[model samples]
Target: MPRILAVDVYQVAMPLKYPWRTAYGEDHTIETILLRLETSEGIGWGESSPLPQPHYVEQWSAAAFLCLQQCLVPAVLGRSFGSPEELQQAMAFVKGNTFAKAALDLAWWDAAARAQQKPLYQLLGGTREQVPVGADFGVMDHPEELLPLVEEAVAQGFPRVKLKFRPGWDLPVVQAVRQRFPELVLHIDCNAGYTLRDAELFEQLDRFRLAMFEQPLGYDDLWEHAQLQRRVQTPVCLDESVRSLHLARQALALGSCRWINIKPGRVGGLTVAREVLQLAAEHGVPCWVGGMLESALGARHCVALGTLPGMDYPADIFPSDRFYEEDLGDPPLVLDRDTSGRPVACPLEAPGTGTEPRPDLLRRWTVNHFHAHA
Candidate 1:
């Protein structure tokens, strides 16, 4: 078994190509924490973007850093774990802070994979080499500003598209997209912007025949989502609500959602994500991978998780160039198209994720850094 030798945490701010506006807020630059874990055998990298604020979830960038440096790192710094679950158990004493835990969890998984000389997906029991990915468009000032991006995504051979939905950018924006590309596979992510009071609005949206409506209610409310699901024909997909496997089971039992969006960082890294996917599979509910605008390092884990069975929906994974002009991680992620011409993302055959922060880029973007040794 490989024992953790040292850990490095970097607080980096990677500039986005444009401001990504969602229901929670707008992000001009994605401020995230990246972890580099060195083991007896090799080194591995991980990332968790809590953004600059806690509006997306309870965790934020600065808090996640402190949690890792003061809590998570100390829990398993000198420990040797045979499995990712063991590493997770070591940090079980800490409550919440899934993003902070994920930084360590992801690095352990990556390091373990590299130690065994296997692709991360293969180690995770993935059934496929590549999976289809979807393009996402954030909220724009006008439908006109959004249409061109949708058109570009379509022309680029993406199989599906996700549009950010909020109060002012709701009906009219969706109506415009539907008019332009009626047959395009479309879904809307509300980022927990609406409540059950907007059930009528969701009911009205059924006329558009979306693939699903994602996180329209409160981020932590399951009962309201269940009630909202009962009144709407479009399938409700839970994002922020499904934070853990326990929450996933509750959502399924209460009929809170028909689809689940699994993000590694949101679910405490790939260990819990795999458990949720398996749970969703057993229940016959489909699942899809979602992203947090991470650089190539984190996006690689999303791609690997997407390869598992029952991830039927196109993922929110995108190429590095989609958001960043120059990627922060080495070996920039480029989409691989299948024979059908649909854009897809594939896990690297090389050991681990085959990505890490470029030394120069890391030095340029890092606002804070912490290091600890066994």
Candidate 2:
């Protein structure tokens, strides 16, 4: 049996070039917990980067940080394990701290792949070497400001574009995008910012033939979401509503969502993420991985996850260079188009995540860091 060697946790904060706004809040910096799991064979890395506050979910960077240090880290230190799944099974008792547990789970998976000297994607059963990618355009102050970005993403060959929507910004914003790029693959992320009365808003949106209307109503309101689904021409894609395998099943059984956006950190880790993919596939629901504006290290995890077979839609990944000015390190997330002009992310060939954190950057941005002995 392979005994875990060490776990190192680092708190990293990097400034974004521009503030990205959504229905939840505005963010100007990316803060995350990067975990490095070591074995005698090698090192494996994973990231748990939630937003600074709990706008997206109840878990924030600060809370997740402590959860890993005080609760999650202590649970598995120095423990022996055959595979990442085994470690994940041991972690169920920790409860609700999905992003916190995700840091450890992802590192273990990366560690397992490192031990075998195989790509994380291959170990996770990914078929495509090049992953189809998509980019999200956050809510802007003006429709004029939003158009250029959309045009640029389209010109850069991103096959799908996700736009953020709130109450006032819903109908007109999407209408304007449709007028400009009539054929752009599009969807709107409601971020659980709307109410039942807003069903009429979606009715107007139905004419645009959006790929889906994502999380249009309140979070955890599955029945209402199912109600909205039947009333609209657009498929309802759940983001905040579906967290675990059980919630996903209920969502499916209730016809709550036609699609799902699975964020590894949001769920726990790739182990549960894979389970979500399997569940989505069995029920014929389309799914995509959502990014939290991760630095290079975290984006690499997304690249690894994108390789799975059930990632049937364009993953929400971005060109690292364009997404972040500085990162832990670079991975081969270059943007290009496939035969049908769908954006593709080139998979890393080296074992594990294939990208290591740059030491200088880590030292400069690390607010705090600690080590755990196995």
lDDT minimum window of 10 residues, candidate 2: 327-336
Model 2 per-residue lDDT tens digits across residues 232-288: 989999988876878889999999989988888888888888898889889999788
- lDDT tens readout by residue for model 1, 1-374: 88999999998999999899999999999988899999998888889988989999888988999999899999898988888889889988999898888888898888878888999898889999988999898888878888998999899888889999999999989999999999999999999999999899999999999999999999999999999999999999999999888999999999999999999999999999999999998888999999999999899989989999999999988789989998887889999989988899989898988787889999999998999999
Off by over 4 Å in 1: none
Estimate the TM-score of every prediction.
0.98, 0.96
Which has the greatest TM-score?
A: 1
lDDT of each: 0.92, 0.83
Best by lDDT: 1
Off by over 4 Å in 2: 339-342
Clashes of each: 0, 1
Compared with the true structure, model 1 gives a TM-score of 0.98
